[model samples]
Target: MEMTFPDAAPPFLADAGWAGAAIEPIPGDASARRYFRLRRENGTAMLMHAPPPGEDPEPFLRAARWLDANGLRAPQILAEDTGAGLVLLQDFGEVRMREYLDAWPQDEREVYAHAVDALIQLHQLPPGPFTQYSLAEYQREARLFIDWFCPVQGLYVDLKSWTEAWEEVLGPLLARQRPGVTVLRDYHAENIMLDGGLDRQGLLDFQDALVGHPAYDLVSLLQDARRDVDPVTERAMLEHYITQSGAGPHFAEDYARLGAQRNAKIIGIFVRLWQRDGKPRYLDYIPRVWALLERDLAHPALAPVARWFDAHVPAALRDPTGRLGGTFAV
Candidate 1:
């Protein structure tokens, strides 16, 4: 594949130290950014090609420093050219957890347990000045569903009717919950790497880390993209997390509720990605997420909201709202 950069390659790479480096394109996430593996006489380093002025690397750098300082495996920054939006970082390689899972399905439990341990390690950190994710921010993100997906489906929603209900149900639910340390907002299969000899996994794409619910990142991992985890395995992992963290029996209930909320928000996000960003591949994962939401709703913890959904929201609308594979005009 041809290399894609937002702008021309930086002039520094042609200088004395980095001359004759081999620059190879590396896989990236769902962002307008690119990465290259730069192998030079100095050593192997990863170059991040984010467009100047639009996508600043400062946040990523700061988050990386914070995570690295706290016993996590974030890429170490080696060199940076802020003016050109290029950053040289430790090469964590391109083996995503999704690929590893595909190659070794039998190791899913053990591998996922490691990820759970990582989450526990992260949540153990004391509160810091990192970003905070509030109900208002979540509501703002939820609007993407109305603005993007609803239009694509040719369905108009009375924002006044459901918006308040959503906020009302979720507002206190999130507000009353105990706050945690930083959360790696996108800690899923694609963002983790199982390096061959490394004792711990490598973390990537954590620039959006926030101080939010303790279970949020764990839910993001076990309930992931690129694969469907068996319900039996999901329960075991949930129990393992609860036990290992000493969060007590109520932890399971809290985990289920948070998982439901997180899954609902993600469904909306995937739909918005398809409708607005033209990334329709994410639509394939809708069924898995919907199944999770439905299963979570079955739990007694969510009975009130689930009953509301069953009564006010039609069964046909459930799958559509969940972005399952159904052709609805737009």
Candidate 2:
């Protein structure tokens, strides 16, 4: 993909005395946003270029400010150009928690505990500026599986029955909670940095934060699609969060519900990244995501949705290579 920089340096960068800072492209995630590490003799900074139509920095700025105020380590904004979707920010260093855990598997427990602590801190914030994660939103995201995943397998399953089944599964769960905790919509290891200078967990890519049930972020973290957080760590983290947060007895069910819902949505997202976004590598993760989804489906609360899946989506559809070739690429 072509990297588009402003005609000149962003005025904000120039104003911040970064006129001759060396520009280095930082790897981006699944989003359109790009980051560059700008280094100079005195200091280092990050330039975020999230070009417009869909990539606005306003919401990110607001959320970062709220988090920083509440004693979390969201990057401090040095400068911004909302018109150009540019932001100059504090550099959070190189090691993502994912990479850290890969290098030192023994530290998984300690690292994940801090991640849990970060969530505990985050959820404690007074309901801030964020949209509610409504049932409509959940259903819409779940439909991505039907929209994108089906086409790859040469099938078109009408999602009316699926949505109806979801209503049966999610209706009670949604009613059990409203917009209470600030859910960092994407809280996986990839978005979390391990910068000891700031906070133990350095938060990133929270531009899509929402006011929702706490279990959603927990699901995102423990049931990560990109990396396997082992069963022991996963169980310990859940118990720790419940103990720390004082969530009631039904917390486990809520976690399972959101975990199922999230994994279901991600199945389509990975497929869509290939079919629509022209990024085929994500297809490799389909099986891992399916495995996680199947586990969540085993929850008793998911019986209705599980029956729907068993009836409609066959076993072949669950495994990426069962019907579609493992080398399936568009």
Candidate 3:
């Protein structure tokens, strides 16, 4: 029995004389949440079916309200039935950044600049109690690489050694960051939409936004797995962010470090997505993400983590980890 909005449609919909509308399923992310496009006499709206008793729509609705209040383009919650996990949200269209970039690669930088600007605006907002990022949380996420990827690839990793080195090197580096800003945990291509009608973009799946490093979202955008953003464009975007934020020359180093950290986390995440979630589509992008990580590691700021990866992980593993649609060559 699949749970759906009709099962939980608000009583007010009937009281207000709203007829049941057609629902079309939309592609979803890794979450169990599902979306449907609904059409009524009035217009179109998005219906979220999160299922009953298992998931709650309150957090998402709260975050959406907070984001909308802050000049961000998160969908406004029209109505919600928290007990049944159903919500009606404003439709933001379906032009995912991935699709937009594929259709016009040349225009990617400009469009992505808009995304970065949105991120900067989000980061500039004052932090709230609901948002915070801790090193312990990051370390736990990083471990997904070892837990999920190692078994899927039929390889044994000395995670104990890796964790010790990771803490010794990357830990302190991340610890130095000034936190307390809205960090959209998955601020990547798929979660952004290029809505032609709005003359602007919209943000999606931002329920995980937290107070963390401002550079984290930047890395998430540029070092995306589903799309390949050129280094030249990435550099220009970085410079644009620096200029806009009025950050000093040291900002470059911070950006590089954050990039390295974000890429490492993604490498682990992609592998886990395939091994645990049956989403092997993400594997093909590993090489590009690894290449970006390698480049960032070359920066002086990331030397410690670079040396740790070089010494612990075999060089031959690079191509094998990245080559999708085939088994590891080495």
Q: Model-by-model lDDT, in order?
A: 0.72, 0.85, 0.73
- Model 1, which residues run further than 4 Å from truth? 6-8, 14-16, 41-43, 172-179, 197-199, 311-313, 317-330
* Candidate 3 local distance difference test against the native: 0.73
Tens digit of per-residue lDDT, candidate 1, span 1-330: 236743546565654255567878886666756888888676777888776666888778889998898899999987777677777788887677888878888888888888888888887788445778787766676565556545555667666755675565556556544565688888888888877632469998987777877777877887775578766777888888888877655566666676777776777777776776777777777667777878777878767557655755456656724454454223
**lDDT tens string, model 3, 205-252?**
877767777777888888776677888988899989988977656667
Best by lDDT: 2
TM-score of each: 0.87, 0.95, 0.87
Against the hidden true structure, what lDDT does model 2 obtain? 0.85
Better of 2 and 3 by lDDT: 2
lDDT of each residue in 88-149, candidate 2, tens digit only: 99998898999988999999988898899889887777878889888899999998888877
Give the clashing residue pairs of candidate 1, or none. Answer: none
The local distance difference test score of model 1 is: 0.72
Worst 10-residue stretch by lDDT in candidate 2? Answer: 320-329
Q: What's the lDDT for residue 114 in model 3?
A: 91
Ranking by lDDT: 2, 3, 1
Q: Which of candidates 1 and 2 reaches a greater TM-score? A: 2
